[model samples]
Target: MIGSEKLVARGLGRSYGDAAVVRHGRTVLTERLDRFLQFDARTGVLECEAGVTINALIDHFLPLGFFPSVVPGTKHVTLGGAIAADVHGKNHHVAGAFSRHVRSFRLLTASGAELECSRANNADLFWATIGGMGLTGIITDVRLTLSPVPSPYVSVRYERASNIDDALELFHADDHRYAFSVAWIDCLSRGGSLGRAVLMRGDFAPNELLTARQRHDGSRRSPTPRLSVPGSAPQFVLATPLMRAFNAGYYHSHPGAPRTKVLSYEPFFFPLDKIRNWNRLYGRRGFLQYQCVLPSVGGREGLIRILEMISSSGSASFLAVLKRFGEGEPGQLLSFPRVGYTLALDLPNRGPEVFELLERLDALVVRFGGRVYLAKDARMRPETFRAMYPEFRTWLAIKNEVDPDWRFSSDLAVRLRLMD
Candidate 1:
């Protein structure tokens, strides 16, 4: 199908943008391709179809004391999407992106030829496809290395920071001791409270740390109570004042002193999963998730400027997160992570105003040597995209080599003129 027509392979449609949509072109859904092809229990290497989801991986393997080396905020994303985006997680400072653990994959090129790609075999194609956004080819199967853990629970420590500097200090002072680290920032806070956050850091819980019941529960898929937004919300649901209050309430709720607790992996990693259709909170127009990483050299100052802009703009973000990224994988040219601080903001889509605000944010990010996550972008200009990803030329060269006719394309690809 790919050889004869313009199309794009889609996994779970979890990407926030149109990376999976092809406009008038065909979309090949990989859901039916879901299957576990092979497994090496001793070494923890598992080969599975592209459609296999993080949720399935956890439900099946967590009981056996294994987990994907990296998982994004949600588990609904498929393995193919994870690789296409080179998704990172809370432990990025330690684990790097998902592509780092990928051993190899089978790619069906535009010519209908199946190529086995890895660091040592067809190496160029391997790195290209890692974060290539499915433009190079359709990924059929993947061999990945899973990390071993003592239990399914995570032992988490929470600390409150009065401002952005305090948060950075807390993270820099202790990031090496924890496997996972993230902070919930109050984007609406101003003055002395600007960038205030609650930092959560943790590692997999050891068996000795678990209670008798927890040991017996051991990776059992317990049913978590869920709530769903019944319908499209009113535009005022996320009004600036309401969001400001929510941010304040959340900030003051966390204890100022450090606190520790053992939590199931589900809540620790995917808190939003508990609220189904949470996006509905943003109303019928939806919301835009702008995520960017500033190089550590100027990251702190960049964050302050960015936060000040957001606060003054009055387009409050109901959900904001701050995290530190370690060095990036040299092989994945288009991958987003680097040694820096990344901030993600969930802003209500208020038409032109929101776009204008994002443009300003983009300029600041570029000035600070930062780049936005392609997986979450929907409205970035072509020139801005070029400015953020300097390796696009190299990635384009490989795309042209494997898919000269541009057989695989998406709304995102065309919007950014990726082929040009």
Candidate 2:
């Protein structure tokens, strides 16, 4: 804050896009600030530095029956990073986005003055920070409201949907009853099976419902240690034919499968966590994740167009997930949730051709009044961002009031004109 006039405060750099990178200026890496400040176990409220990761929190608190109220697919993200992105999870259809569970946090403004912000005090800053993508100010520490779980295991059920319509029907039917739900969509599928998906639904399991093995494993902890990928898998490994085959096997393996025996929270809620440096699998080229949420109206059409774009382009995505999102907090202007369906795609950086194909998908998202998630974006154009996120301008107005000099900036901010 003192030495650098321009700085981008970043946590674990888990954002798939340039949202966490400083384009030309220096970056104030916040990972070192990690420290567990305080905790109220009974109330499931805890205070910690912005740099404290979700994995760290789980390792320390899960045994006590408290966990993040809403978590994304991975646990490597930090508290500050989560707030910046306003991350959401499979349970978003019921619990809303992560910002709803954040109690308050300490904000370090451009002038290096600290302000305590929340719904009641400095409400603008609170809302701006929730989904403001860290452009408003620098987050230092946060007090989070956690959820109480019966145990560290989940009662899961799997069902395969024949097509996109069936998948939507299944999600709408069961979303109300389950705390968490998501589906793995087969992007490579074509013809009558376009948008075919494997649906997964689950909720925290009560201790009494845990299996003997799970109970013996103390609520089902991970047996294998997390390991980092040394490098990207050979490009040939993800060829369209191979991916199609993998998807076919996966879909056939779980068609109408009965309820699963108990699954641990780590594997269920954070499967990627088991592989420490999974990102490296994308290779030195770095991959991009395109996540977009389309409102219910025209959602099916928009999704179909997106898939069609990918299909015609022959750009195969190895991992794709689709889920429903509920309403979000008031102040979280940039929060990526609404009454709609959200889809996330993992694209390994094959080259310019792949990026060009994504641009077509972006056009389709914008046409349908859907917006791409800033957390996972890497190549979205500034014009497209403005058109998709109508709140972008409003958030910028608030950001200007705090960091008028553009002290807090990132490659994302620069690209999207968050600060000009």
Top-TM-score structure, candidate number: 1
Error of 2 at 266 (Å): 1.4
Candidate 1 residue lDDT tens string, 192-257: 989999999999999888889988877468465568888889987688898899888988888878
Off-target runs (Cα >4 Å) in candidate 2 are 1-4, 219-228
Lowest-lDDT window of 10 residues in candidate 2?
219-228
Most accurate candidate by lDDT: 1
lDDT, model 2, position 241 = 84
User: Candidate 1: which pairs clash?
Assistant: none
Candidate 2 at 383: error in angstroms? 0.7
Write down the lDDT that model 2 would get: 0.83
- lDDT tens string, model 2, 170-266? 9888678989899999888887888999888889998899778778776443456547676767777667787789888989888465456577887
**What RMSD does each model have against the real structure?**
1.3, 1.7
Q: Which pairs of residues have clashing backbones in candidate 2? A: none
Off by over 4 Å in 1: 1-3, 222-225
